[model samples]
Target: MAILTRAGRIELANAIKQKSIYLAWGQGAIEWDTQLPSEPSSSTELTSILGYRKATRVLYCDADEQGEIQVPNGRYKIVAGPTPHLYCQFNYDFNDGLSKSIRELGLMVGTKPKASTPSGQLYFQPEDIEQKGTLLLLEHRPAIYRDQGVRESFEFVISF
Candidate 1:
């Protein structure tokens, strides 16, 4: 699959909203739920895109909890605030071997999802950290990468 361009993202988001589809994440018996308006994501997508497995689950937190809970293929809505954006946090528990593989692959740690606006320009903020129960409004689009890349991309509009 080809990388998603700016215009592609907007077209995808519009399609997702019209369909009100559910995005799936993860593979091999592991998958997470997805929020509408944002792209459909899964652990499998992250594993392939980032080129690593062993990511146990993604965590969502807020002012209430620091490390709250673990969600398998979890999905949540985006809530708009002072800064409007969508966000999700994933927690990885890599085994010894997998950790080494990641480093070898030059996969950077703490790399968040690449996002863009309707115009297709990348947009994000430093404070857009993933928190539990933080609503992430998303715009869903077609998957860009092949293999796991087939997964749809969602642009975060706001966080609750």
Candidate 2:
């Protein structure tokens, strides 16, 4: 749950200077996965399918609620896309005795979301984020998006 600790501020500062960061979305219960990086390290990685989905996107680190380089905490919003991305769709129904259901949403961060082998990935860094992925900031949260076709907007807030 801790993105940047007191000791990781230096790395966080360097990461903040990057033009963009990778955002990986997934489905699961509303809880922190053990795979999430408690702190940036060489071995942090994501494994479970419930906590990981292939549909990933590159996002700008533009915090709307605060400045771009807000230290203690920085917020980044993923503007709603035109169409729903994978693992981001939602459907609900109350017909059969309250059958309303939704896919849990989780967020993770990395240097890049390359779809290639570990070694072939761009901006690959083990400590920052290896091919396996890193920084699971958000655990699954049930979002009620009745229109599955419409893209959903998401926000990521990280504090150092």
By lDDT, who's the top model here? 2
What is the overall TM-score of model 2 with all chains considered together?
0.36
TM-score, candidate 1, is: 0.19
In model 2, what are the clashing residue pairs, if there are any?
A: none
Cα lDDT of model 1 by residue, 12-83, tens digit: 434333331112222211122232233443212222222222122222222222323222333344333222
Model 2: weakest 10-residue lDDT segment is 83-92
How do all models score by TM-score?
Answer: 0.19, 0.36
lDDT of 2 by residue, 43-129 (tens): 243323321233233333434565433333443444432111112211212221122222333344443444444653322222333
Reference-based lDDT, residue 137, model 1: 28
Judged by TM-score, which candidate is best? Answer: 2
